[model samples]
Target: MTHPENPSTFDTVLVANRGEIAVRVIRSARAHGYRTVAVYSDADAGAPHVALADDAVRLGPAPAADSYLDVDAVIAAARTGGAQAIHPGYGFLAENARFARAVADAGLVFIGPTPDAIDLMGDKAAAKRRMADAGVPLLPGYQGTDQSDETLLAEADRIGLPLMVKAAAGGGGKGMRLVTDATDLRDALAAARREATSAFGDDTLILERALLHPRHVEIQVLADTHGNVVALGERDCSVQRRHQKVVEEAPSPAIDAVTRAAMQQAAVTAAADIGYVGAGTVEFLLDVERRDGDHQAFAFLEMNTRLQVEHPVTELVTGIDLVEWQLRVARGEALAFGQDDITLDGHAIEVRLYAEDPSNGYLPQTGTVEAWQPPTGAGIRVDAGIAAGQQVTAHYDPMLAKVIAHGRDRDEARRRLADALDRLVCLGVTTNRTFLARVLRHPVFAEGGATTSFLTDHDVTGVDLDPRDVAAVAGWRQLAATADAERRSPGLAGWTNATWLVDSRPLRVGADDRVVSLQATVDGIVVTVDDQRVLVTGTPDALRVEGRPVHLTVHRPGGDRLLVHLPHVDLDVSDPTGLPPGADDAAGAGVLVAPMHGAVTAVAATVGQQVEAGSQVVVMEAMKMEHVIRADVAGTLVEVVDVGDQVGVGAVVARIDPADTDG
Candidate 1:
């Protein structure tokens, strides 16, 4: 192992990224005694990564195009900061060949693959063609340059039904659509094209025949500038929603020794063929239906020309710090060991924790993280960029953190991950923590049989909120808040006449508007919700509902807002008395509001136009993903917001006159 005291080629490195990846790279760079520099946008001036770095530079505003994605600005920052190299992390311009070339032209090393390799693998169509020429098996698809809608439609017909339309210039499930019917082809193409153009500046797409119940697996490949390439192992990323991976695990349960060896060899070959250097991932779609002994049919997907978000699982299993290896390779170092020296160990599983709601159709959420407490234990690891009081805006991806667990076997790993997820407490915004925990504990996932359609085929999103638990926590929070107020105001406490008076408060919990009534008594408090009552005893720190102790963490982020964090559930409690009449209720029946904070990219609805329920009225772009806001009730549009307008959650974008109304 190389020691930190040993001299390296680069003495200082600039991380041209933000969030957790920047923090990860800075940690690795500092561990090797290299000075680290961080770049931040206006929104991240006080972010953890900024404070962690030895030096920092301000880029621009919050939007990535003006900040992180601006190659000139990033290079200028690196030069001004006296950085010898730049690490692009996983997103932004990490896989951009032009950015890589710019860094090299600026006389600074880009801590990733060569510009040629990135360009070759960055284009899905070109990469697929190259892999096919190299004798790599590929799924039947179209990768031609004729991108006209007419040509694409014809090719879709020729390729047959159930095809996947994917963006040729990007991944991360953006600009990808799965079309199973001919009627949906045109709409899918338009949506895919719009998203691709917005995300990657390219509307070009490729079509491939959709595999039946396939396992989405990718092999982690590492190579240096020298002639050495090795595949660490494979990761199963089949548990997905909207083609975006949710859960991933190293040493895929579906893969046997024979299949593993074949996939590894193919991945290494693909890397060498592209002259790949540094860390890259070769993704493949493994057909679960085609199984013969240890051999399974698989086809090339596309190569992620940089370190993957799920790289931690592979690192745990192989005992390798991929970022360190990337830095080493960027310094013109050769691979210290060959494939023969690489080995895999215990099982590891990772789940992405996002600030989105599964029940609300997985809409992205934005707000301040009033309270954040990730789990901590021997086998639990959390790579998160968020902290208490940090704002989660619509400027970036909704993924807040990643929680991983490693154990001796799959079951142990699964159990540990589930427990860790249950222990996590994130408040002041909606999240997918409960949904992820449910999936991890589901029978199909536990048995290692989850496919790409796991989310589609299962009811993992529905979390039955127990009114008892909600009321108990709400009552506890109310009493705690009263006690706090009394401590601050002795006059108010004296006016309350605590010995003779019982104060009653009404609070609303969750988006469903479930109301809980609490009454403070001399002996603890009484909680009532929907005709059910329970006696809560003990203090705020150790509360008992009906003689049963419950563990809870409470945070008050302003007037009437209480965040109660319980096991496997976090409830946002608000005082209904503090809200204007009907403010806590759902939006008016004929109004179409923004489901989340985003820019209105398209408005299909016009005033005086009649539309049916479920018709898409507005399309919003946020967190690099597009969401179509549909009409909740059939009506004639009376008012409509225009495109290019930035809207907040619950802001009315359109107003419609109900079809049954005479107005």
Candidate 2:
């Protein structure tokens, strides 16, 4: 079965990336009989990818500029580790033409498109011009090289109201903003430019007329050096928040057979025109309101010159190993099959699991992953980059894993995905697990009507939890802890008149400030929460709460932390006992603390400056995004943290004295 004429190009590959994508690439390279090398920064020295590779090399520090994005460091590591080829997996330099050229100049194969192709499609302005010339429908916008403020402002006026300002060289929704009001144009432009320069080292921008109620669809294309290309199919990526995709599925419910064929043809044409090689995706915005004759009108959005994050959905449906195809095509081999050989077998859906608090405006959270247990079933697949005891810092993206499910039909797939999310458990930090389940089960999504404005249109922040179940789980955990402790020391179980004394403890669950009491009893345990009594009977493995049986999985990672997994809810409970009496529950009430770990980028307040409540005082940058911190109470800023200072969660960045206080 081996092609003797086209021998393999390399025996070893260096994955010049980190996290889940790196682990993904390493698995495929090793399966193809190639040894794999992994590169890591100081922060990822103990990551899963490093441990999975045959050899590992250090790049530099934690900051991407000094490590993952450092061209010299990556090249040196590849050479030092004797890697015959380099695979830039999907992020830092995957679309950088200069990086691809550098790898070729170093006499190593770059397992991606040609440098010329990357350079052609990497710039949004240039890519749009080429697509239009090739007879592809394009949205009206300004991609001209007039970089003056006056020209851009004038162009905005000409382009009409409600336009989008996007970074020409940016991806992953990093440098994009939607502007509706004319008065907010200048500030939006300046902010977009600042973020663009910081993220991609390029401040060039392109403006486009915003499409209302559009469906985001993209077609996957594969090509080889033998002058052959094929379109795999389309993926519906319409569910988004803040312009970033959260849920993706194959075989879009919005398009028909005729539309699918037309989109596929256009994608193939676009790739052929550029002489593209390797795996790429062509994105389009289908305006649901506008129609060209009987069909929907779609305009070319942009072409991702690298593998996309949602590629797994395509792979599951088409029964294709895209990574293997990438390696084979890089070795001058033709595609094993033609477009006619591809067939869709089933429906698949994937949701990104992130370390964020949904109720708190989805702000990124950071901590050690004390416990992690992904769902396991016939149709579920988990692509995770984290493990127990791994520290999730603010230096990288907040995504922890991806949960994907495949089934015979769309409804079957949706139900399976929702069940998998309910069974999943992650502790030591807040996550959007429950929120994702709610979205999948929502009637709007169940009816296959989720558009780009799904999150904006629906309220998915709430989930129903019985207070009785919460109290019962907490009580069971306390009883279990006491039994374990009594086993260790018999005398610790105090006895009065030859009978063991009943014990009671207090617990705090979730974000609620109310404390519940739990008491040990001869039959089982009794819980008092919100002036209501609930009886919990049976053991920790199986419990009967008010005559209803429930299965439980409890984990005490350390200290006062308790993770209890019920049939429907997972609770992270903590017991704050043995502290000094009269401790202030609201310490630092007037002080502004950093909500997450990040570097302070801007400080707008001086120590002696008086400010009103909810005044913006500091701006922090983390994970390539910016967050503004505001004062909670009106007061004079007594102490202010400086810009460029790295702060951790709960660290006081600024202090405010009450306005009524005299100097």
Candidate 3:
């Protein structure tokens, strides 16, 4: 039932998400002469999306459960703001079938796939059934309704080893685990079920045969009411960490013309089978086993019945605005261009710039954005949500912005991405900037063999701290020490610090607990490493280390540390450990510590329960991800945090009483 409407009839539309995607949607809506309404949580009251909207409405509080995920609140905001349609900007309630139905019931057009399509694709098990019925390829495994662990383990043993346990209703790689051994099947099932329950509210599990070197390839599909479904080429989302996509690029390097065409056709079939409208993506795991002479196989992963985060890259390459198409399709208008008219012109790559520390197990970083600047140049675009001074709390996704670059070829696109990274700057919070740079610089990445397990195979575990980087760090630290000593004494280098003979202080670099001791002298500076002295000299601003002038990028006050930006790297020198312990661990041993600042969603551990190493102890929800704290060593659980409790970093959540280990 296509509603006949004049082209460009939507005067107002409400963005139904927060952060960068909301801002991105608003900007697109405005570009098409549609007035935009922004809905915000309490934490995002002052976010950039709120400032960019034609009208803004407060939904609820920081927790997504109270705000963005609240269907009634979002619909109310749309109605109060006089929006004719609501555009869910991915994530949150974007793919919620009930929310879509509610929006339609409220007489406001939902600018996405129909509720039927959402329901068909939102559930992984159901979607697989549809795809399988549609003759799409599927990985060999069980996707049944059985919930018993014993049954699942038996099925896994029958299906063979190396399989993935996935949530039947999950997206974004949450509630996913790889089981390679039968002995660990029960634990994997429990953990995956727990994560799936927390993430998607559906604990039902599905098992898929694992591909050793799988590349995550997906095809973008667009559909209209006129039965026009077009597959807009393919994208490679192989670079991932913790099962979450971090980098994506258009036109996969692994697929040939035949494979690409097959993939596109599969996506079109998947979309058409569900009578889908609007934009959607069909994800597949491409198996490349050249070593075993196994031909490449693409299996149906899932269907995201909404616009993807990497849609910008597709838009850039095709010169087609998917958002505009979504609006047009929702308005009952036929697509402006046909498949024959569309051209996949240049290559485009998108990198998600998140407020996270990769070295610290990718923990979300929270702080006020003191400075936020996105790179701007030809073929460079940034969809950013926060501005300088905006607080990036731990209440939402760590993704602060998305940086995309376009070029005539992959090399040119890579170059443009690097150039943009150089101009991009953010202060007052640790981000994945340095790690993104490393990924781009990776040799295999340049050669186009980056798979989903790239990080697992590569040595990115010691990110931001390399041996070569350490030497340069020492050089920069000594230079800063020399300059500080000169400034402390007015007579030397014509400066004053009100102290003489700069004392030796210990400075610890990032992650590594090893300390480098340095002392400031009138003539020069000296760094003692393992009781060996290395002479250094420098000015306060510029230093001549061994007659080579070294420049320090930033001088952090209250210490002898300096931020040094060199030709090859950047380093920060500061005390690794701060503040002395208030009490001995023996005084409070067996006290459960909060993994990080977050709300306790579930406390699985209890008094007198014997737990093994890596056993699930407590579940803390932070930045929308449920982190399960495990016992570091085998012990008897003595205490635990209550469910629904909010705790800060280092706040005790649970503790295990030590038990004798000698058998």
RMSD of 3: 4.1
State residue 176's C-alpha deviation in candidate 1, in Å: 0.6
Better of 1 and 2 by TM-score: 1
The true-versus-predicted C-alpha distance at residue 528 of model 3, in Å, is 6.0
Q: Model 2 over residues 1-663: C-alpha lDDT tens digits?
A: 111233365788999988888988899889989999999999889988999999999999988889999999999999999897898989899999999988887888888888888888878888999999999889889998997889999999999878999889878887788899999888778778877887888989999999867899999999998889999999999988778889999988888777788888889999999999999999999887777665678889999998888888899999998889988887778898998998998999999998887777778899888788999998898888888788888888888888999999988989999999988878777788888998898999998899988888898976666778777777677667667878987778433565534445566666554467666567667777777878887766667787688766778876776787764666777765643575334535578888888989888889889877888898887777777888888888899899889999778899898766344
Per-residue C-alpha lDDT of model 1 across residues 1-663, encoded as one tens digit per residue: 111223255799999988888988899889988899999999988888899999999999999999999999999999889998898999899989999988877778888888899988889999999999988789989999999999999999999989999999978999999999999999999999999999999999999999858999999999986789999999999998888999999999998889989999999999999888889999999998886456898999999999899999998989999998988887778999899988889999999999998987899999988888989997888888878888899999899999999999999999999999888989898899988999999999999999998888898787787877876777677667667888899558525534644445566677556556666666667777776887888878878888988888888788877788777788887867688786755576778888899999888878988888889999999899999988888889998888889999989999878876344
Each prediction's Cα lDDT score?
A: 0.87, 0.84, 0.79
Candidate 1 lDDT (Cα, 0 to 1): 0.87
- Per-residue accuracy of model 3 over 570-657 as CA lDDT, tens digit each: 4556654453585323323455576567888877767888877777888887886777787877788877888889888778787777
Off by over 4 Å in 1: 1-8, 292-294, 478-504, 514-524, 581-588, 659-663
Candidate 2 lDDT score relative to the true structure: 0.84
C-alpha RMSD of each candidate structure in angstroms:
3.2, 3.2, 4.1
Task: Name model 2 segments beyond 4 Å from true.
Answer: 1-7, 489-505, 519-523, 579-590, 605-612, 634-638, 656-663
- TM-score for each candidate, following the candidate numbering: 0.94, 0.93, 0.87
Which segments of model 3 are wrong by more than 4 Å?
1-8, 290-296, 464-502, 508-592, 602-604, 612-614, 659-663
